[model samples]
Target: MQITLPRIGTVAAWRQQVRKLAAAGIDPQAVIWSVGAAAPDLFATAAPAPGVATPLMLSLEAVDGIEMALLHSDPERFSRAHALVLRLSKREVRWGDRSDPLMRRLLDQQKAVGREIHKMHGFVRFREVSPPGANRRAFAAWFEPDHPVLEAAAPFFARRFGDMDWLIATPTLTARCEAGEMRIEETEARQPPPKDAAEELWRVYFASIFNPARLMVKAMKSHMPQKYWKNLPEADLIPDLIRSAETRVRAMHDPSAPAPETLPGGRMRKKLR
Candidate 1:
């Protein structure tokens, strides 16, 4: 009976199964394997010609009657089946394994991170923040993102501001530069932030806008998940701030807390070494 091998996505795992068949006494010399959506033309003379494939091919045959066959009962049971493929991804090597699960995962991960890194390199915002008349120059910026993406993002800042001092603090990590040297620090810990008129006022504004009459608790949680609530400056506003329309109106009317005035790019800048 002609065996029909199962396929996943576009990967034809026939080559691997064929090798296993060879070692298991299903002599490779006796069986012809060709990869495609359709079966290959069998010459029926024992030795079949190799078919064309996008990826290069490797052939193996049993020298004796003892051949190999796959334990089909468990193809994906080996977790390390993908280990070899992952190593290739890290080295930026692309392998043609239409049927290898690990190779597919490595490609997916590389694509996901490569895009995010490219965006961070282009879009990160930084602000200069050295107090006037200070001996040196300094800068700071704020950003909100879902993951620990700072270490991979530090190189962009170093390249952009090789001579200036600055810091980029996200909810999870902080990248800082001093005297033209840059380093990343993990900030999984939280400290009480300095009391700010903006945060308090934002809370008031938030509570006042919340309307019990129109509230949908399920929808609220869906739109604003628990994970993001703690890190947002606007989160504290949700609980008490949204209680009534009157409070919200008062907050809305309040003047936006004025930002501290600083000379645009203070003239006391150091010449890049």
Candidate 2:
């Protein structure tokens, strides 16, 4: 039977549908899962009658892994996850077994989602957007994610910035937090909020703390991919900073350079070293 799912199916939807198919003893191959509004084959079987659901149990780790993997942007993710779920339910398959190709793929995708979540948390910069009459401070940020991860990533921001009102907008969805309440709404691609004074301050702070002596472009890019640079305020400074790194480090080590001193007013002055 062919099962047609929404273009962007949620974890819950996948789980529910999988459960029904599994209960009916339907093999993954027997059911063709087409996502979005793709036309079904003319000879496709109609939706099968749902069987009495057998108690489906899986390790919490397996559940979490598959859930996050579903958020991946890969079009084949649904079929892969479904196959894995079927295997786990019917047999005593160890989800952590790397020898199994399906399990390995799931593991890799899980890691991808984890990395994306970490990057979103670290790189999302909020710019103040309060108007003149606003009693509470407001901020907003624009992010572009590789997966449908905003829902999973929202809780961290909610807890960390509990006292503030903010919105994190992305191409697929927007996560809005206000008055300690969190909400995710479907949204189209949006223009980034206007540049604010705070962004400049953050850029200056980032540059000041950057250590040219430790600069490693390859390692840096490995951790912070180039794809994310467009949304990061500090990224614009990276090229110039990298180009001049050798000169900056040389100045730091040059004995001919001035020694910095603290003045009475707490300002620092430089004198020949």
Candidate 3:
């Protein structure tokens, strides 16, 4: 039986559908899953009523892992997760076994999604925008994420910026928060937003706080991947910063280094002598 799920299915939706399938004794092999709008399949059989019987439960760790794994960009993630869940329900198995390819892949996907979430939290830069007649200022950001994680990652923004309205738009989805409530919805490709005045200040602050003496390009890339650089305000300055790091650090250590000149706006510019 062909079962068409939503293009971006959530944990609750999958849980509800899985409960019905499990109650009806519909094994994973008997059903083929495709992601799209839910439409009546011409050759599909009607699903049976979900009985009152308690469905099989997975451990909390496994459940969390599968939920995050499902958010991965892999097209076959649903099928793989479904198969694993079926095997888990049928008998006792080490869900965390790395020796098992399926389990290992799922765990890896889960970790990738987790890292994407962290990146989104760190990289999303909101720009203030004002519409006529608006009382409180509204902010917006455009981002491109590697995984379908905006749904899972939106809550952090809602809690962090509860006092203001904000929108985070991505290729696949958008998260909007207003008056302490957050909503996620589908979106298409979007162009980069206009430059905000605040970005300049952020750039200056980033440059000032950067420690050239502690430069570690490899370790920095591991934590802050290059994929996210385009969306970050401080990223464009990275190349120049890295190139001049040695000079800056050497000047700082030199006893004969020229005194810093006071620039306009009380900023100090070190003259590398």
Per-residue lDDT of candidate 3, residues 1-273 (tens digit): 776766554666777777777776676655666666665667666553333433567889888999999988897787788778877776646789888898999999999999999999988988888687998778999989999889899999998899999999998778889888888877764765677887877787777887879999999889878998888887877776777677667768985756454344224456754
lDDT of 2 by residue, 85-166 (tens): 8678667578888899988988898899989999999889999999899878999999999987898898999999989999
Considering lDDT, where higher is better, how would the candidates rank from best to worst?
Answer: 2, 3, 1
lDDT (10s digit) by residue, model 1, range 1-273: 133343321122544554344334342334533222436545445333443222222222211101111111133311222233223324433363536565555344444445545545644444446778976767665655433346656777888787778777765567778888887765553332333344554445554455645677678876566555654455754554334334334434654532222122211121222
Backbone clashes under 3 angstroms, per model: 20, 0, 0
In angstroms, the error of model 2 at 193 is 1.4
- Return the top candidate by lDDT: 2
For residue 231, give model 3's deviation from the true position in Å: 1.2
Worst 10 residues of 1 by lDDT: 62-71
**Per-residue lDDT value at 250 in model 1:** 44
Candidate 2 stretches with Cα past 4 Å from truth are 1-9, 32-43, 48-55, 257-273
* Cα lDDT listed for each candidate: 0.45, 0.80, 0.79
Off by over 4 Å in 3: 7-9, 37-55, 257-273
Question: Which residue pairs clash within candidate 3?
Answer: none
- TM-score between model 1 and native: 0.37
| Per-model TM-score on C-alpha atoms | 0.37, 0.86, 0.86
